[model samples]
Each structure stands twice: as structure tokens, then as C-alpha cells.
Target chain A: MTGPISGPDELSKREQKALESLLFRLADDEFVLAERYTEWQIYAPTLESDLALANIAQDEFGHARLWYDLLGELGYTEPDLIWERPPEQWQHSTLVELSFPDGGWADTIVRGYLYDTAEQLRLEALADSSYLPLADRIEKVLLEERYHRQHAGNWLERLASGEGHDRVVAAVERLFPHAMSLFAPGPHEDNITEFGFRSESLQELRRAWLDTVIPTLDSLSVPAPEPAEVVRPDATGRDGSHTDDWFELYDAFTHTYTELENPTPVRLRGEGA
Target chain B: MIWEVFRQEKKGDYHKHCGNVHAPDREMALMFAEIQHARRMHANSLWVVPQAEIAEVDAEEASFGGTTDKAFRWAMTYNDIDASFAQEVADSEKEQEKAAKTREAQI
Candidate 1:
């Protein structure tokens, strides 16, 4: 609220908390969704789909790194932010943490469709954020998100028709509730907007998401539930609360890193190479 | 339909022709291209074009890099000038020498 807080060092204690909330939501969503997407890698319906999902997963992981790097500017190491962070402290939505059903190709399509649409809206809202670093990073994330949305939308249309109809519907019905968590406000949401971190309210983003998703699903001949008909999960996921699947996933992913005991962060690119 | 794939390893880089993939449409072609050409290789972007649409001028049809000697166009042709005095001219001569070696090797 007090002018453009350009750097993390300039932030007051409360402003820092607000920024962390936003960054964690952005980073964890991308990281967890990417992990789920990787589950479909070799198991995707076809070889091409496998590659497409793998590429999408990589794109998301890269996006996550971008946000996590921003968090690193606040003095948190990679292990503190991710590897050694407690499972419940991860702020990713339950939708991403939910495991795909056995051989459920339809699950990946519908999940990507719902998530990418919301992601697009969310990023568009963040494009003009007063927080300079946050705004600066939007373009890179948005460019890659375009391909992801296109990939998901293409599959969504094809899979929503003919013999695949029932499965797509089933997946949507199962995942839609958790997708609601995409806009669930964290404890610092008020500070986030008050500090000009994002222009759109979570309620506004949620409405925009619903308006976009429901109509798209309806056009695909998949009946979307009324917002009133859906039940929100007990865990908001924005407040560091999560589903059991999140705990299991956290354990699985961090196991190797933990067992190693020495967490010398692995660097794939940039100056670290 | 067959589509030729081009892979760009980084932003602002030229896309080099990689290989072709069997696909029914442009979308599917791109999907297949990512796997076929970009799976193991690094890619910032990929382009897929219909094989039939790409114009070609091979050695058997119209000679590539020209059949007749165009020695005057090469940087090495001007041997009177000391190209080493200028880094750019020296680099150009080195590139031309490599190209000449490649041409001779082909023959």
C-alpha cells in the first residue's frame, strides 16, 4: 500500500508475509500440478500425448522455479522453501495433489483444462501488479501458459466427445470441487490486495474462473455443477492446510532428498552449471 | 500426412530442420514433433510444416550454393588484404575456409 515495494529487502514485516503468501501460492501450485502432470508421462493415452504432458510438466516446473527464485530473494534456501518444508505448509490446491485414477487419461485432460483456464485468468490479473518483480515475471509465465492452455483445450475438446464422453464427465465431477481451491484466499489476501500485489480479489478471480470454465464445459456437452451445488473442501490449501494425498506426495518427492542428508541443491542451468 | 519439424534450442535462435513425423494434421504434427525431434534435444520452440508445402532445390534439381565457381564472393579471394588486422574479416575467412573444406570433402 505504501508505494511500489520493488525489492524484498524494502518490505515491512506484514508486507513480507503478504508477498510470501502470493509467491508460495504461485510456486506451489505450479510445482504440485507439475508433479501430477508427470504422473501421466509414460502412461498418457498415446506416445504424442505422453510427450505433450511431459513438456507441459517441464514448463510448469520451470515456472515454479521462477517464483521460488523470487522467494529465495527473501533469504529462504531451496530446502527451507521446498525439500525440508513441512507437508501441511505447502499451499498448493488439493486438485493438484489428488492422484489420478488408474489409467485415467480423461483425468489429465479435464484437470489441465480447468487449471490452465484459472491460471490464465490469474496471471492476467497479476500482469500489472505494483510489485515490480512479480509483474516482471508475468510475461515469461504467460507465454508458456498459452501453449499449456492450447494443449489442454485441444485434448479437452476431443476427449469430451463420442466414446470418451462419460470418462471426461467422471473426471470433471471428481476434480471440479478441488479446482475451486485455485481461488481460495490465504490469510494474507487482504494484505496482498491492500499492498497492490494483485489487482483482482480472490472472489473476483473465482467468479471469472467459474464463468470461463462452466461455459467451456457446457459447450463440450459436459454439464458443470452450479457453484452452489459444489462443496468446498475443509482444507483451503491457501492457509497451509492440505489433503492426505499432499502428505503422501510430499513424502514421496522429498524421500530421496531427505535420505541424502546433504541437501546441496541440484542446479540444471544458469550460473550454477 | 508427413510434416517436417524444425527445432530452436533457445530464444531468438534460428530453427533448424530436424526430421519428419507422420501426423494427420498440423496439431498432431506438432505433438509428434515434440516427441520425435525435441524429446531428448533441448528446444525453446518447434515448428511443423507440411512436407509437401516445403519447396526444395537439391543437387539433382537446381544446384545448391551454385554449381559454377563464385570464388570472387568468398572472403579468402582477396588474398592481397591482411584479414588478420580485422577480427571480423579474419573470422569470415576462417568460416569460408571451413566451407571450402566441406565442399572439397563432399566432392
Candidate 2:
């Protein structure tokens, strides 16, 4: 592996852009995914599950903060990183931005399963990232991710039996294609690889993700349609193109920001004004 | 014929296996435990159980947690998430970080 890039100041102009691209992709996906998960907080099937899922959402937001913190070191403000950024500029995968249908427990579990599986593989690949800060933060993210996987896996398995099986199958059919966007490359895909920001390519992580998830779902009799047969949505968020759902989510989350005339994003952890 | 004592030093604190006392029965065990285990220990509580009632699971018979890595359960795993924002989360993480190190040392 290449030696760590040391610090943001040490980065060349090309390297700086490449790092921002990777960080934005990572941060955006986590922030948006956590936002979706919070939607299930009080609505979960049981009180215990509600608490568990809420804690998981908090973990995701914490992870997003980790990536965003790195970006902050590069001189980006919190508002620019999220609240004030235009919806069209977000780089999260489309899968995270989609709203869960009402009472759609199956959809949430399936989406989480697909996403967490990819997340586990992706984080493993970044464990030895050439960027010291990213590498340093990998262990904590991986630790929390392990719980997210177990939580999703438990729900997926529970739903895959008897009557619950059909709903899971339908959810898979509807969501598997969107989940594929988790591996979709961003604008700095080439530079990220060349600069060793990540140790593995997205394609390799995708293959490993599929190898683990497809069979796990199959064993549970949850139908994951063949890769070639699934048609991807036109809005691949990596290219900054997102579905209408995303715009709605952006407006909803930024509601207070807009009405309050863009108050500074609150920093609950670490140093803040 | 034998009694086991567990002592909790304070409210909300965990009861630990301090030491056992030899006694004839549960009542006697409690009395003996109070004098032998709790005396001078600054205990908030004490528990006494028959040695026979406690089931044994040694290292040879079972793994406490799986031998595989389970760093996820520890608060230290989320290194970048500053726990100082919430006192309890930070406290839990600090405790877990210590436990994790102790666990690592044992292995």
C-alpha cells in the first residue's frame, strides 16, 4: 500500500479533488441513509426493535460525521457539506434516498441488508486506505457496521419464512436494482484508485457483496433476481442525478434551515461555536 | 453445604464475585456473607447462593463471546464519533474500551 498522504495540506491539487470526491460520496450516502432510517424510529414493530433501529440510525449519522469531519479539515463548512448544498449536487447512491412505503417493514429490512452487506465489504476494502485519516476511522465504522448487518440479517431471516417470505420476495424484486447503485462509480473513480485513497475498486467490492448477499438471501428463499434481468433506475446519484424522492427529502430535511434563514448546522460533538 | 457471595459496592453498580463463605443454608449464608464479604467492603448489597445452584461454564467447555472478532459491540469501535456530546454514551465507551483491552489480554 502507498504511504499515507499525511495531511490535507500535503495533497496535490489533483489529489485534493480526488479526496473530496471520495469523501463526499461516503459522507452523503451515510447522511441520507441515516435520515431514511430515522423515519422508522417510533414506527418499528416492537419497542425493543425501535430502540435498536434508532441507535443504528444514530450510528450512521455518527459515521457520516466522521467523513464530514475529514472534509472539514479540508476547509469545507458544515452547511456547505449538507444543509446549504443543492439537491442536484449530492452524490449518495439512489438506494439510500428512496422513501420506504408506509408499513413497508420488508422494504426497510431488504434495503438495509443489501446496503449493509455492501458497506461491510466496502469498509473492509478501505481498512488500509492510503489516507491516514480515512484508515484511522475505518475500525470504528466497521465495528458499528457489524451491528447494522446483524440487525438487518436478523430481520431478513425472520421475514423470510412462511407468510413473510412473499413480502420479502416482492421487496427484493423492487429494491435489488436500486441497491446496485451502491457500487456505482463517482466522478473521481479513476483518481481514487490511482491515488490509493481506497485499497480496492468498487467493482471488486460489488462482486464480494453479491457473492455474500445473493446466497444468503437465496438460503432464506428471498428471491434476488438475476443481475442482468434487473433494470437500473435512470437516476444514478453518483453522477449528481437523483430521483424526485430525493428532492422531497432534501426539502423536508432543510425545512428548518430555510425558514430559519440558514442557521448554522449544529455540532453536537467535538469543537463548535 | 457451601455458599457463594456476590457483592455490589453501590447503587447501580454490578455485583461481583468477591468471595464465598461456608454456611449451612441460605439464611446462614447471607449472615455469613454480610460479615465475611460485605464487612469493611463498603457494600450497597450482597447476594448469597448455594454453590450447587451455580452452573459452571469454563473456558474449555465454552467461549464467553465467540473467538471471532466482535469489535462492533464496543463503544471504542466508533472512534470518530465523539462521545463527549452525551455523558452516558461516553462513559459506556470508556468502560467498553477497558473491557476490550482486558479481553484482548486474556486471549
Candidate 3:
């Protein structure tokens, strides 16, 4: 068993690099996905659903904040990590960067279901992380993620019973390949695993995710792409390459900070504030 | 009879009033509450009590926590004393902060 790493100074160069790689993936994925979720703020199917989705978006942002704050312990500022950073430097899965089709509520719920299931599995893997900061925050993040999974699963079941079924199916088919990128390892996978940053390997998390999600989707009558048939997208977003949509989103989100000549990003208190 | 349903979302969590269900009796009220209020939500357990059994004292009946300021009871009143040194103290301060806002809204 690995001992608790109290802070950045405790890590070697290789360990630091591995931690950075892991942090970038976790932070970027949540930040981008939350940005996408904000698009449905007023445009969701109903006011109640709108509020629910908006809360989920805020939860994702809060989770991102936790990861980004961990990175700060290594001497990086928020501007250096986000607003002022180049779009290509981001290491999120392309799954989050893809734009939602207009009024595609089905895509929102289905994407959430896919992401949350994978998130639960991966967070569980990090529950006993030797990195003290990471292990400390996992429980709170996991608690919030449970609500997200329940929200998505509730929507998926309700939608599948009505005219929304076809839309959900289309979303599943169109996005499955991209969603698989969630478990695709970064270059520091071996270091991340060997250092006990995460107790389970990405391959194990991926298999567990598939086992849980496949049957859940099947039960809803929404056909998921078979595990063997999932091909990684050309731009997986883990390698610093992303689709054009990511650049567009990056520009929009950072427009204010870029134009102001001040790189400070605004912050609000409370988890969902 | 109308029976109000309160849902405990998870273990150790407080039960909150969700909504009321129409039923002929207490037993049927619980059965209806399970389907209506607890069906779609993540509820660990639920309680259904007859609406009439709940006594209420509205604003017109009684004033709550008094109309005068009771700032001395608040942790924030002694803001110079740092609560940050202890997590429990900080948590209590936060709860008091929320309670203060809620009391203000009530007044």
C-alpha cells in the first residue's frame, strides 16, 4: 500500500507529472461539460426540468473547481490553468466538447447518463488514492454525482416511454464513440496507476462502466453500441487535439477575460451558486 | 381525506414535505403517497400523516424568533473571533448564517 502524499513537494518529478495529467483530464472534462449544460438553462423542456439541469451543470462546475483547486497546490493559478490557457492545452474527452443539437434534450439526458455512470466508477477507483487531497474530496463529489445519475436515469426512463424514444436512440448511436473516450487513458496512465493516484486501472474502470451502463440502457429500450464496436474518435481530446467545436466553445467562454486584458475568472460561493 | 407526505431522501437526512395525496384513509394514503411522491424521486423512506393531524400556528397566530434583532445569538455577531480554526465551529457559523437569512425572510 502506498503512503499518503501530503502535498506537491512530497511528489517526485514523475509523480508530479502523473498528478498533473490526471488533474487536467478530470478538471477539463467537468468544465467543458458544465459549459455545454448551461446552454439548456432556459431552453429545457419545462421550468422544473430546466432548474434540475441547471443544478446539474453547477454540480459539474463545482466538481471541476475541486480538481482545479488541487492543481493550484502545485503553484499554478486559475488563469494559468483555464482562461488564459490555450484551447489545445485542454485534456478533456471530446465527448464533452461536442455541441448539443438544438432542443436535443434527449442528447442532454443520455450524455449525462453515460458520463455520470463513468464518473461514479472512476471516482470509486480514486476513493483510496494515496494523494491525500484527492482522497479527501472524493466522498463529497461522489455524493453529488449520485443525484446526477438518478436525475439522468429518471429522465431516460420517462423519455423512453413516449415520443422521445427515437431521439434518445439517435443520441445513443451518434455519441457512443465519443463517450468511450471517457476511459481512454492519458500518456501518464502507467505513472498514475503505479503511484497509486488511482487504485484501479482505466481499463478496469472502462469494463465496469460498460457492464453497468449496457444493461441499464438496454432495459430502457435504448440500444447502446456494443462494447466491441466502440471505436475511439480521431480526436479523443486526451492528446491535446479536439474537434473545432471545442475551439469555438473555448473562445466563447474566455471572451470576457480575453477582452478585459485581465485574466481573472469570476467565482461565486456555494456549490451550485 | 388529504394526507401530507414527507420524504426522507436518504438515511440520516431530514424528511421534507413533498406534497399531499388524496385517499380515503391513513393506510391508503401511504399506498398512494408511495406511488405519487416517492415514485420518481430518490427516497429512502416516506411518512404519510393526515393533514388535519398537523397543527399550525401561522404568522397571524404567533411571531417566530421575535421581531427584535437578536444579533447576540449569532456567531457572526462576534465576527472578529475566527471560527475557521475548527471545522465544527465553521460549520455552525455557516448554519447560523443560513438561519439568519431565513429568519429575515420570515420577518
lDDT of candidate 2 at residue A107, scale 0 to 100: 89
Worst 10 residues of 2 chain B by lDDT: B31-40
B18-85: candidate 2 lDDT, tens digit per residue: 87766545654665566555533589999988889999889998887798887777888567886568
Which run of 10 residues does model 3 chain A get worst, by summed lDDT? A263-272
Please give, as one word, the docking class of candidate 3: incorrect
Rank candidates by DockQ, best first.
Answer: 1, 3, 2
Best candidate according to DockQ: 1
Taking chain B only, the TM-score of every model is 0.58, 0.58, 0.62
True contacts kept of each: 0.25, 0.00, 0.00
lDDT of 1 by residue, A187-231 (tens): 899999898889899999999999888899999999899998898
Better-scoring candidate (TM-score), 1 or 2: 1
Assess every candidate by TM-score. 0.78, 0.72, 0.73
Ranking by lDDT: 1, 3, 2
**Runs in model 3 lying further than 4 Å from the true structure:** A269-273, B1-107
Question: Which is better, 2 or 3, measured by TM-score?
Answer: 3
Runs in model 2 lying further than 4 Å from the true structure: B1-107
In terms of docking quality, model 1 is: incorrect
Q: What does candidate 3 score on TM?
A: 0.73
CAPRI class of candidate 2: incorrect
